[model samples]
Target: MPPVAFLHTHILVVVLFLVFFAIKAVLLLLNKRDTLDRMRSKTKIVDIVLGILILITGGYLLFLYSGRIPTYLIVKIVFVLLAIPLGIIGIKKESKGLTVLSLLIFLYVYGVAETNSLAMNKEEPSVAPITNTTTELPVKKAPEEITPAEAAQEEILNAMGETLMANAKAIYTQVCATCHGEDGGKGLGGAALLTQSQLTLNDRINVIEKGRGLMPAFGSQLTPQEAEALAAYTITLNTTN
Candidate 1:
């Protein structure tokens, strides 16, 4: 299936699962034993099936983006692992609180994914020197002799660079993820596994700009700098593996 289409399928099943969870939670909370007794067998089986689909679809997408997981994603995965059992046990034991807590945790995961790309866009822009003159370079010094202020400055620069990389990843997610997969190894629709690709940087950039079979050109959609950043991030798909 096309990557976007597969993603849509994944999302659909997720929403369906949440709906089923809500229904079961309400039934348990309201003590609707009569209705539950009547539909219990079918609903239980249906819920199990839905849960399985959710896992399979999620796993497929994760496979597409194997490495280079963001910190927030790690958090979401942890919460999901916690939420599943909580939700199941809560419903079986008729514990409203646990069910509600599980719902909230899943909500957090959804929120993180929705806002991830937006958050990447908010990174601090690179700072440039005001004057570009032949300033005398500082002599090499021992690492232990570095001043506190210099160390702090280095930390800030490092943070900024990290933010830029995150942004680059976000860009790739938006434009290239569909074709390249999350880990850039999906080889979807016969595209090459980017992690295994041997194309040079210039060749990759040119292909992105000009267009190739089954893939549209992105030069008009993205600026040169943006494309360059995305290309750089794509390079990491291999390095990360």
Candidate 2:
């Protein structure tokens, strides 16, 4: 399949799954047992189809990231692995809690999928240097200490950051390079030479995300961080040339 088609199907299947789960969650919450039962009976085949598509499409795409999977994707994979059993168990046991939990999990995966970030409320903390230790052999500067747990988490985020830059490079090559040229100085696509662009980073992000005139809108095509990375990458084109 074409990259665009592959991406489109991947997105559409996941969105449809969310809608399917959301409807069921609402029914369970509203105590509409009879309605929920009827809908279940009618939608079983269709739901199966949706689930199959998600697995097939998702699995096919997974091969592309074997050595380069990002941290957020790891979280998403875990949730997707749980999704099937959660659905079956939730409806069979008529557990409102499980149903609600499933909805929230899916939403989190959605946020991570769309934004390419952990989407956690808290930021990962940086390592701090121990200061002013008493009885030190010397009054020298203290080396930074990173707890083992914090180090692992930082490693994951750093890998995620690397993944973002790699993605930005790919996006620039495949989407922007044709017009901006490899050096980003050519305007063959009638695009403003990215090297000469005076737009602020945010402005460039806005234009890329929303598009202007001949440019295509990437708001839905690229994640926010990916857009930001691409904006940053464009500036490097000038330096390289």
Candidate 3:
């Protein structure tokens, strides 16, 4: 199945799990022990099934992730693990404190996942000015004084540069646009704003090849030359703006 299918299924299972817990907690709070027990008896199999599906789908998504596992995602997983046992023990022992704690943790995890943050805050990503690395080119012979061979070589080099930039733009759109946006300021999923980046050209290439934080490594997907070209193109974004 496609990743989207698994994503949808995971969402459905999570909602159902939350609803089940909500209903049970409500009954417990209302002192409807008998009703809660009756519902639990009827849904024991469902509870187990939901737990399995959550783990299966969540694990699959994690496996599909191209980057290093994100911090928020790791934290969310830990909370989920903690909440499940707390919930089971709470319901089994009829402990309102434990049940409520478990429910709150589940809610917190949900928020973290939605915001892609540990603090659950969706703050705008800040842009930093890029450091200038330009240097004066060595003095070239006057155009009229240049040999025919040198002129042809220069022309070929210019064409190659343009071609690389075009390829880099296409690659960026195909692989990085979803998170970085077309102009590189979208910052979705914690992507760095390219226009605001402060890294030198070489540093940008390293980051693209190895990745940092939420960005996935493209070393396997992009050649070193391609990585260099992409880095060069990202620098242009800063200059153009």
Candidate 4:
């Protein structure tokens, strides 16, 4: 389970014991007419043993959730220490008021502990925008819908040959030049270390998509079109070198 929830469980156990102790202390103080023989012996022993258990469990919790020690836990520990002397005084003087006051302090400690536990348990909110701008843009209408002159000026793109080569050149200069050098001479940071038998276009594309050694995966960062363009561009790097 989560650290905060685990800590809260321990705190709940300790608080239950404190409540029982407080009630017994109050009752003993109110019924002074009865002989204090059995009450004094049993109350002292139970309180001391319970107190030690609380301390031990609290210390264990501190170690388990050591990554984050809330300020509230520190305050609760201080109040618990103060409650010890107040509890002793209540028993000695048989003061009902002191016992009630101790209970109130314990309640406050419980409240703070529960609140801090909830705050710590909460997940952090997301900061990324809902819509990605890089992959989405307004599509332009065909020039045929406009004037005839504009339609005539719209030259057909060579989807397989010249256009592909031009697109490959542009992609290569923009993305590959920083790593593979302008003349494919293995001069970039990682490229400089790679041997002649390093990798082919397909291997390089796989490494870029699924990060191998020092490179981070760009599968999520780059669009499919961008990845394809880069892959095609890389194939032509040493073609004319």
Candidate 5:
């Protein structure tokens, strides 16, 4: 299966696991012992299956990272490992304290993964200046980092228009995440690692609008503005200068 299929399967399994756990936790907290027990008995096989699926799918997705894993992802994985056994034992023993604690940790891990931040905040725009060998230069800020005036100036410079900056994250998630992966380090299907990309902004835009090697040109699928937006978003994934 393709990496995107694995990504989708991982998400679906995780959602089901969270919802199932939440329901069981609520029933236990409300002292619905009979109902909880009956539900658990009926779904015993399902519970095992879901657990296995979570591990299988999650492990496959992690494998796509190819050693360029981010710090937040590592932390998320640690918490998930801690949460799973706690949840199982908590549910089995009817311990409210452990159950709640495990649930909280799972929720936290989900947030951290989605936001790509330990603090669960949206990542700040990657506007930090790149250090030059001989002289300091202002690195071009991401679309989200620019003021309205700066955006207008950018439009003049690139002629892609301000709409190119709007909803870039959403665009990247929908159109680029399959090959690039979430943080752009997946390198699946021969996709380049965006985090280590050294291409300038315009060059990146050209690649997105055109095509390089195994990657197909998205020009027909995306408007010029949308293509530019995706290019700008990919720049934020660059961690290496």
Candidate 6:
């Protein structure tokens, strides 16, 4: 299941439990004759079981799907803990304030869950060239007949192309690996980039340069030649036979 779906299901369960408990507590506080006799039998065994399930599923999503425990979950869990005392007070002493506090805490936890949910939907940033490498290639000498200006232009274009390729790789790692996997074949991230027919070398180049949907445009951040090189490199991802 998707992380979002799992989280939504657990949250819904928690909300249901909170609503049921809140109503029951309110009825008891009012000392309603219709509910007073039945209040003693309204044990929260089902709520406890549902709460445990929510905790288990939530833990799995945090540690497994996202691969890291988000701070938001920790904060939500703390508020949930606080709600426990409020729930106790509501049930034992028929405290309206405690019931209200419990409801407020439930809303706070839901808000935190929504915020953390966005963490999975983050868009990757455009790739930038790494500039600190010490290894330098010797520049080729231009023909004696060629003007210095022409040679300089050629050199600039070559450098620009190289930079684009480097940036493309970085972009691929950031945006594609989650679905295409690190090598682009395992499909661990979502789909196999290497095996996809929609993204030819030229198509990939265009997509990176122009972007489409979830992809961010690299043309603004990368030179055309650099984008071309990165596209070329991506073509070689699954061709190592």
TM-score of each: 0.50, 0.52, 0.56, 0.41, 0.61, 0.42
State the TM-score for model 1: 0.50
Higher-lDDT candidate among 1 and 6? 1
| Window of ten residues with lowest summed lDDT in model 1 | 128-137
Candidates ranked by TM-score: 5, 3, 2, 1, 6, 4
- State model 1's lDDT: 0.64
lDDT of candidate 3 over 1-241, digit per residue (tens):
8554576688789889999988999899899999999999999999999999999998887777665787888888899999999998998899999999999999999888666678977544344533322311111578688767545533433444666777888898898877677776666544666756656657888999987754667889999889977876776556322
For candidate 4, report its TM-score: 0.41
Expressed as tens digits, the lDDT of each residue in 1-241 for candidate 2 is 7433554587788788778778887888999999989988998898889888988887766654324466667778899778667866897689988877777778877766654468643222132221111111111223366445434433433444555666777888898776566766545313556655556556778888977634667889888888877775664444311
Q: Write the per-residue lDDT of candidate 6 for residues 18-91, one digit (tens) a residue.
A: 77776776686676646743643565676677778767775765454323444665677788878866876666
Candidate 6, residue 50: CA error in Å? 1.5
lDDT of 5 at 211: 67
Clashing pairs in 2: none
Model 5: which ten-residue window has the lowest total lDDT? Answer: 129-138
Best of the candidates, TM-score = 5
lDDT of 4 at 228: 54
Window of ten residues with lowest summed lDDT in model 6:
129-138
For model 1, residues 1-241, the per-residue Cα lDDT tens digits are: 7445666687787788788777777787788967655665678888788788778876776666533666766676687778888998887777889988998887776666554421423122132211111112122568898767545533432333555657767777787777667776554433445655555456677778866644657889888866665655665555221
Q: How much lDDT does each candidate structure score?
A: 0.64, 0.65, 0.75, 0.52, 0.72, 0.57
Cα TM-score of candidate 5: 0.61
